[model samples]
Target chain A: MTRLPGTAKTPGGLYAAPSLVWLSVFFLAPLAIIVAYSFLTPGALGGVEWSPTLDAYRAIANPTFGKVTVNTIIVAMGATAITMLIAIPCGYYMARSEHQNILLMLVMIPFWTNFLIRIYAWIAILGNEGFLNDLLLSLGLVDQSVRFLYNRGAVMLVLVYTYLPYAILPLYSTIDKFDFSLLEAARDLGASKMSAINRVLLPNIRGGVLTAFLFTFIPIFGAYAVPLLVGGTESYMLGNLIADELTKSRDWPLASAISMVITLVTTLGVLLLLRANGTSVLGGDDHEAAEPAGEADALGAAR
Target chain B: MEARKLIDISMNLPHCALRIEDGSDSVAGPVSATGNGLPRGRALQGGIMECGGAKKKTVKGSDVVIEHVRKSFGEFKALDDVSIDIRKGEFFSLLGPSGCGKTTLLRIIAGFEAPEGGSVLLDGQSVLPLPPDARRVNTVFQNYALFPHLSVFENVAFSLRLKRAPEAIVKARVSDYLALVELQAHASKKPSQLSGGQKQRVAIARALINEPSVLLLDEPLSALDAKLRQHMLIELDSIHDKIGITFIYVTHDQQEALSVSDRIAVMNSGAVLQIGTPQEIYEAPATDFVARFIGETNLYEADVTAVSGERVDLLTAEFGAIVVTATNPPPAGSRISWTIRPEKIRIGHTEPRAARDGINVVSGVVAEPIYSGFQSKFYVDTASGAQLKVIKQHADWSDEGPELAWKDDVWLSFSAEDAYIVEVRR
Candidate 1:
């Protein structure tokens, strides 16, 4: 076999060396240090102690930590579900629309501003004396300002809004590559409008839907700012709990232990989702069996 | 062979005679007439019972009558007052270059598009108001449009499953259609795994399983390689024969249209210029556009100088006087255009002794000679400085013989009947 330039045996490894070194220095080193710190005792002065202990691991069984974990999962799942409901249609329209680029630009326009600024802008709209309340009051639909902000509902809404683009972009990319003629083919083959979309459109873009779900769900699960700003004490999640453990409580070992648990759980969740989607996170060889029965050919023939 | 058998069976059926007499002669008769003349023999054999078949059975195919249909996309008119009558069981082709509205017309028939005006009648009932699913018309999209997620069996059974067909019935029908397309072995394969021709066959099988009265194909074979395309064309023709359904095929390739279509409508700029049987379209083109678009032809602009009983003498700019045969001669002094196919012109080294009156002969030097495997095209520069193309077929297998090289003096001759008059288009 002819050796390609820069891809020959030793040179290929040499080419990858810099990225490997960078990842090792930035990621592996930090992760190793965190793992080491997770096992050690907390210093009195908010620093690491050389003495080892399983106290941090034992503390993970606390009811408060369990509640925080449950709350985090609930909020993430809620945000993902709501985002998908809105994003699928939005992505489908953007993919099929003639002015796709303009629509995509509009979807991305929010990203041009600072993320925090946009979040604050939402505060102005959803606050007690905000635009929604003022409009409702002027229309005589409400007797007084309702508590729309600083609640679980507010946190979910803001999370969904903030992560809507993540869901839409991946969905749009997959849907855009979709051959819409399949829908037409379905319709032509004696399928009703809705049946055509359900049978042809949804199944074809399952990968994109899964990708979008994971993209939004993982980040929102570990989100810090959205819950901190919008959520009340009752809505405290794993992110807030971890932040409190590190800052207010100044318990570095327990915090590190909690961080490791979160990392492990998130990684496992992502792996399971990826496995269900028939893709691999670490670039392993794909294991999905070839789809049986050529749908297009058989459909065309049937028609 | 299968087509001939199908024709025989259909001809023997008692109800076939009435179908022939119900104005289907113009479309159906000519289709079989052009295809090996076997259908014509079968049609004639069944003619004895023509007057007395009681109980008209429902025909297997649907008749499409597009009346005064017009469609526009913004400022651009895609179809302008286009009308056509596609007979049941006829392979009709809409032949045109790109952007000539052939695909648009097919889409309208398939109910993927709606016309701005007029109505589309299928089997004497207006289908214009119906959605695509409600109409008994299916389309084989240009790209096949196979669903990547489903298997071949599911794709073929999509329509049946939608109608909630019994699982056994769906399976049996899907297998039958797949077998028809010779894709039974590939029933479990995905579309991505099949070849282009295989995918096309699957698409045909899918459309056919719906049992549509009319099947519309939108340039379905344009994606295959040349050899595969020819093979698939034959397969498509056989499928049409087997089903005996009206096939409204759209194509830009003239040879493909001529090879498969019973009748062809040549369109340009959203308007149909001529509609005729393949032979009629080829041997006697109605207009200059049809003449040039169908095949290669040498066209000359001439002024009619004299008109005899069946011959018209014309004065051309390059060739002084040329006599052409026309049953009804045009008036003298009228300017007209005439076309002669390159194949009609005989090229030889010396003047032929059999040359007769009304047969024109011109001597010219071979400007260029291009030798293909089966024929040679010679560009002859006449004494008047006008060049004419002549194609001569090589009947015998020879590496080199009867060669006419560049600068060789050659004689070109054509009978008056070989030159046809084409209407001058402004």
Candidate 2:
């Protein structure tokens, strides 16, 4: 068949060729190397050798590594949960507000500052004799400065603060597209204001919620800088473990293996979340998921 | 604002005063079964006082009395002291052009928009303090607004679910309402999957499943095509008949209001110009705006040359002297406005020889003839250089290519009763 230029029968793949090639060169190739290294022996000089072994995977089963994995999961989940809790209301207000441009700019203003500098700014406020401690001392609220930084809580706080805009932007866009008239319909149908928002508004914007969760959770799962700068020994997470193995211990295979585990955990978490919500990851169109109706149906009957 | 109120009061005073003068014996009518003092009188000439035929059930609906309701947004007054007494089980319409505050009044009644001043009462109890959900009023929004995330069955069952009804009851009631709107088969489908008419039906089912005391429909059929609009109107009327709940319908379409409403409140510029039956609104409009808004009419300003017994002689600026009927004729030599419907003016090639008793005839040449299938409209330019529109119905086979083409010499005539005083211009 004689085909015109740019009109091939299966031109979708051809159109995607650039991204495919780029991903292969820059992303997938690195990922493949990491996977290969995870299965290979670690060389003496901080690199993988030709001999293959399951030594790195066996090291991951150590209680120390296990403790870091669990700690990382807890921090990631907590930070994401808190970020979403703050983001949802901010998104709703921005979406419904008349000064949406200003609110959006305010939400995005944090991004203009460098991420590390912003983290440092948080440390300056939360450190011993920081702004908060100085204020407390001036107000005579405390006799001594509180040790607010260098802990798991500090890592979570910084992670949440950093990732909040990521959650808010997707949420705001989805909510702005939502038909607000449905909320009125819900109220007209005898639902109080709160119930209307919960049943109608939340379910309708669940796609945005999922997007916000993944956006916050996945990044916080692999958060390196926040933990490194704000966290103490008790707050050493998976990101810190991978960094320690790669740089200090020079266990290249172990670092690659831990990176693979983080990737696996995130992918599996995303898949489970999508399945639980009965939504396809690619088909996260706002109206595609109708699974929440089950809870509404049950509630209707119960009510 | 003070001057506007004075003008409003002066305009509405005559409507009630004239009805009292007619000796219809219902000026202060007995309270309806629903206990609302709705003044169920034939308030204007040609106003139909009786309710619709046989299908009407007992009054299970709430009486909505919106009194002196005023609201504004920034500098724009959306509703200016708008007051309407919607009777129980009445298919009442708030008819006006866009931005005339008909939808705003409906929203006020639905508890969606709070008024700056005034009280809205349901069954003689003030409902203004109650939230929309606490009030027994449900609205079928303009765009349907069916929850996109919910299936048709769940959408219909939403209210019952909120009340925590039994599972079987919710199921049965949802099915019944879905059947009422004829979407029982599509209950499992999402609202996005439905056609415009079907989506509208789902919205109707959703709102009506609650069995609200009053149903507020805000331009519900406006999104549908012409044919579907007509069909949905009929379906809406039937549903109203079956339910017998008070329906406060808001629309810009006059024909829809005229065909469906037992009473219509015609509004303009955020104020109600007139309120009466469709016949009263069409034949005996209280203002020049109502005459122009309700339907097509030939409206003109004229000097009242003489007035005697029910016949008023008016001298037009161009068409010369014309005689019209008015029960309350104004003083002689005062400038006034008058209107005659296009269909009321008969056009013929020669002089009208039938009845000259109360008929006024004017000779003119056809200026513009617009021929639609069912009727033809002719803009006739008189010998004195005034234009008049005459609509001739093509109800028979002989009307198939009218003999009177454009620029044809024609004579137009109408009985004095057909041409009524629109307003006495100040």
Candidate 3:
């Protein structure tokens, strides 16, 4: 019962070569370029004239970059945290329910109306005298209209509402395999509703939580539009900062440095979690390590 | 002779006064019993049987009583008017095919689903009013339902932690059950690390670790391979004896139910057909449904021509007038079903015994012998075209082997006692 190892050529290896070549060229080369760019020094002439140096990473320790990095992390982490808090239960409810057709339509409804347009729709929603403020004022809930636009709250709200689907989809996939009968076993074991939720439900979904977190978190660090339209100048994430560094300041070198840092940190996050569980928050496309053991195949197929 | 009997001096009367009273007719009208207040009970007008000293089994208590239980989802009836008694510490089974309401019955008993009509009782107390966690029964679900995120030890320790037992006792008890399941080495590893048999054992251990009065198992061994299932039968029997708790095991696997259950309630179309032991269920199923469901059986519709002593002749349209011993005779002129187990129909070389032996035997060509390694079954066809199955014993006929091949003329005989007669509507 010896299975043949793949050959160097033939229809059996039809898919492998193109995939390997494409991955090597597109994926590996870009990461290699980013790594090469990270260790290179920028010329005084204001373009990326490469001189091998660790000065770019050293420049990242500057106070301006540090503050922006911290701010970027704060915004990303906040949005990721908030989105997951909403999406995990949403995903769990969707997974453990029989209303899949309707729920899927609902989950896809946000997708049907365009992603960028969906964010713009939120601008209409959070406008000072828009639907929300007007409804609230007429209902006598607030004496005066509040500043709903150009704020951290607006950014957080749009972040959650916009990337909320991203957080939910990964979690939905994981929760689909969450062994719901295990929850029943817990309840049958005399675990109260809260105890079952905390002891049974939460731990099984931790992988989904981390996945959804990374799905929403890393993307939030690099978001350009949502915070721009929603939060304005105060909530300048690294994506906006990179855009400004490249466009407004005409500083391609610094912009590349920021992009390199973004790529590096995302890789670290992916690597750390993938090292722990062998699957990424975003489906790991680049790992050349041994595949996750055959057990996951049986489990995934069973699910 | 061991020690002379000594009466203690503390037997002196300590009571001061003797009081006697009579109960007045201050009793209110019938209390709201089953939520809707359906008038129930036959009380002695105004009699109150106080529980002081002498215990009454009839009036006082019962275990795992499901009465007038009906449950539905939308328009589909999952359980309808299902009522049964599960005695204390008995290994009872709710056995049926898929969608026949066996698991639903188990769930209703576990308080997972509330029945529409009647109530569920555990130890004379209604559990229908309680949530699943409040009930004194725990369920081991199909696929074991062991926590994949937790180790075997944590899975068993889970209920103890939920009950907030002391750390030392929880550890000791969890270890004891881990040993009981024979997975002490795999205690620290998660469920993903364990095999299917080990997982099911852990699930059973987890359910029983709470020491609930009743344990509900919903096809817990259906996930295992055939060999594992056979192995689990012995393991489950031993565990049942050791735990001494009422196990209400629900499964569609008939052999599993027959092998493990002390009593089985065969359900079909949301109703119990019969409740009996495995042997009783197989050898003498009360209904056609139960008989056919419990094992391989042959059924034929016929009219009883004569009811003689321990034998009757049935005139079947397809098989002509066939005679079989009647353990219980129907009316002389009545349409009845003749059910005979496949193995009970003896296929022999000689002519089957006639009048004195109580019945006529069908003579047919051996249409085919389906060989499945262990046993060769005979599909005999009478000239009248009724195909009857008979399991030819491999052990006896092996030495005289290969004689009963295809197209060999054979006589299938059986005692009238082996055949059962039931009223046939069509």
The TM-scores, one per candidate, come to 0.86, 0.88, 0.76
Cα lDDT, all candidates: 0.82, 0.82, 0.73
Q: What is the TM-score of chain B in candidate 1?
A: 0.87
RMSD in Å for candidate 3, one decimal?
13.3
Task: State how far residue B254 of model 3 sits from its true place (Å).
Answer: 3.1
**Candidate 1 - CAPRI tier?**
acceptable
Question: Residue-wise lDDT of candidate 3 within B39-105, one digit each (tens)?
Answer: 1121222343221221111111125888888988888898889889886656788899999999889
Q: What's the best-to-worst order under TM-score?
A: 2, 1, 3
Provide the lowest-lDDT 10-residue window in model 3 chain B.
B1-10
**In model 3, which residue pairs have backbone atoms overlapping below 3 Å?**
B325-B416
Query: For model 1 chain B, where is the 10-residue window of minimal lDDT?
Result: B49-58
Worst 10 residues of 3 chain A by lDDT: A294-303
- Which one wins by lDDT: 1 or 3? 1
User: Which ranges of candidate 1 are over 4 A from the true structure?
Assistant: A1-9, A37-54, A279-303, B1-59, B395-401, B424-426
TM-score of chain B of each: 0.87, 0.86, 0.82
Query: DockQ, in order, for the candidates?
Result: 0.32, 0.33, 0.24
| Candidate 2, superposed: residue stretches over 4 Å from native | A1-14, A279-303, B1-56, B395-402
